[model samples]
Target: MKRKTHSVLRSRSGASITFALLLFLVCAVVGALVLTAGSAAAGRVSNLAQSDQRYYNVTSAAGLLADELSGKKVTIVRTREITTKTVTEYKVNLAGGAAVNANKIAETSSARYTTKLNERPEVPTELADYPTDTNDGAVFTDLTFLDTIAVKLLLDDANFNTDEAMNQSMKNGPEQKGVLRVLHAGSTDADPNVGVADPSSLSVDCLYVVQPDGTIILTLTNSTDKSGETYSLRIKLSPSINETESETTETLSSNRDSYTDSGFHETVTTRTTLTKTAEISWTVSGVEKVVSAADASAQPVETGTPIETDSP
Candidate 1:
């Protein structure tokens, strides 16, 4: 009976040991799976952050280009039709953990430029006054003043040439005497032609004039006709102020009320002066923008956040 009891006890001990080993093995496998899942989640987050950074860079580049093309100043206006190119590059760093493991990145986008040469002059209301004689010495009146206008226009076909036509059209002014003269800023005295002379070449025109009151006016314009092409237009103006001049003189006269004539025919004299000046006035207008050939197919789908930094 004792020997049989010992055998049963030993068999039971062996089963307990086996069960413990099995539990340990299962626990180890579960732990390993949990660690692997956590690593994969971290990797995915890193990838997303990198993607967002790249988007920020691209958008920043686009904004900078827009500012350069559009400003408050009148540029010389490009002489050639613009063709843009995209140059993109990327750089990465691993020091910032999986969240922001990227560093400095740069991209350059450029476009060819052209000028527009067909712009309308702005008109302004002005006051004019002139001195003539003693009675009704001066006259005051209002005048409608015309400002200078110039622009650049892009043509539909690159091969087309319209230089001569443009000059002719711009020179078609009234033949009557006292007609306003339109002098091309830098044209020769023989032919003061204005407007784009060649359709193939981009045209840039600038206009300048002063009103009777000495007020200056300037205008600029831009245009294009390329399909899928984008153009930006900007304008600026500066006017001059008028100045006045004056003079003074001395004179001597006898006192008639005091009866000073008894002492003798005292020397009598008189003094007088005339004043003249101009009044200037001006008005400006004709600011416009247009685009052609937008690519609908090229539009990209939004995959994530459209903005760069959420706050700053």
Candidate 2:
């Protein structure tokens, strides 16, 4: 009887030990899963933050340019297209984290750039009178005041070449992936472009001039897969001019304001300036991406290829 009781006691003890082992194994697996999920969440957050930073970096630079142009003083006697030498020594500082520092000018030898300043009809409007003109019934006045500032910048040939390759790669193989951003957009509420839509569905064209008020245009663009259009922002070539002038900057500064000076009765009021946050965006790819040019250049023909037909 004593031996039988010992055998039963030993069986019960073995069962308890096996059950405890199973429970510990289950707890360990659950703990590992929790840690893994936490790590993945952290990684995703980090990536998103980085992406946001890159977008903001470009936008900030564009805004700075807009601010400068819109603030520039034009001759009150007769407004003319002012030429700014900012591009005289074009500079772009590529940050390690994909942030572009517009203020951080890069000194490059032998690279010459000529840029146009704000081109206005009449002189820029007074700051206090900006954004609106409450009362002005038609008197058939033939005066169109300059009320917006726009700035144009072209990606350098080297950068554009690499970007052109990427664009070609994506064009040939729609499977290829790329990024697009909206650098700056003008106010559409005042004067909207014919077909350009704001809060755009982001389909159709690679470049969308959101507003045609002469303010910043080409703010957003559809991805290659979506637009199926080769990027084109060249104003002139032999002179190496690509981006538009600073007309965009001045337009945005005076986006709203239409008053007859005659109505002012020569009050001699102080010029009111409107300060706005600069928004910048353009569909450009960079060589820093390091895509094999072969993917784009290896297409079939070479030599006699016309630049007008194909660029970089």
Candidate 3:
């Protein structure tokens, strides 16, 4: 009886050991599965974070490009040779103007970013169909009058004949009245007829000149220079020139009796504010930088012409 009881106890101990071993194997398998799932989720999150960062970096780069372009001044000479960079290279040049030898007046700025990283994912395109922004009155007017005024002054002061007047007009106006007259009076044609006024000019009726679209072209003779580029800026007069002109006419007549010719013409001089767009450009190494906007639209004025206006 004692031997049988001992045999039963040993058998029960062996069964308990087997059950414990099976439970440990199950736990190990579950732990491995949990670790694998956690690793996969972490990897996915990391990949998403990297993609977002790349997108922001690329967009910021584009903004930097536009800002630099707006702030720099560049003269387009000839189209330069193509260059290769680690990321991307910009070849700058001008169209719609006379092709001159490449002159490096000055660089607007250094490269915004320099990296041997991958090419920019977003390819940039040119911004098209923008007018030259300047303060010159010629922008609002047909500009023929601006050219002709110089010619007329040269003829009157310099005594230049028809042939000389035409040539002087085509070239920029001379700096001084004496020079114009001397050049004109010495010409072979002594008796020359004055040419007709250009009909293309818009009337400067009041403080502002109205363009075809009925938008007033407020001339800004002066503009702030940034990055060595002069921007042509035009703005609309406040209070609308049409309304202000009427008010001025009323104020002028208020002190006088009806139909009485006042001693002085009542003119309203309205103050105006000007907004400017800066012109900027740069080159990729030897690749020439071109200013297409400036070249096509900028009409050159004679550097030394004395502006004249006789007071009424």
Q: What local distance difference test score does each model get?
A: 0.29, 0.28, 0.26
lDDT of 1 by residue, 96-125 (tens): 443322222322222222222223122111
- Which residue runs does candidate 1 get wrong by more than 4 Å? 1-14, 71-153, 156-312
**lDDT (Cα, 0-100) at 272 in candidate 1:** 28
User: TM-scores across all candidates?
Assistant: 0.26, 0.25, 0.20
Ranking 1 against 3 by lDDT, winner: 1
How does model 1 fare in lDDT?
A: 0.29
As a whole number from 0 to 100, the lDDT of residue 11 in candidate 2 is: 75
- What C-alpha RMSD separates each model from the true structure? 34.2, 27.3, 35.1
As a TM-score, model 1 comes out at: 0.26
Tell me the lDDT of model 2 at 210.
Answer: 18
What is the RMSD, in Å, between candidate 3 and the native fold over all Cα? 35.1
The segments of candidate 3 whose C-alpha lies over 4 angstroms from its true place after superposition are: 1-16, 70-73, 76-312
How does residue 303 of candidate 2 score in lDDT?
25
- Order of models, best TM-score first: 1, 2, 3
**Ten contiguous residues minimizing lDDT sum, candidate 2:** 234-243
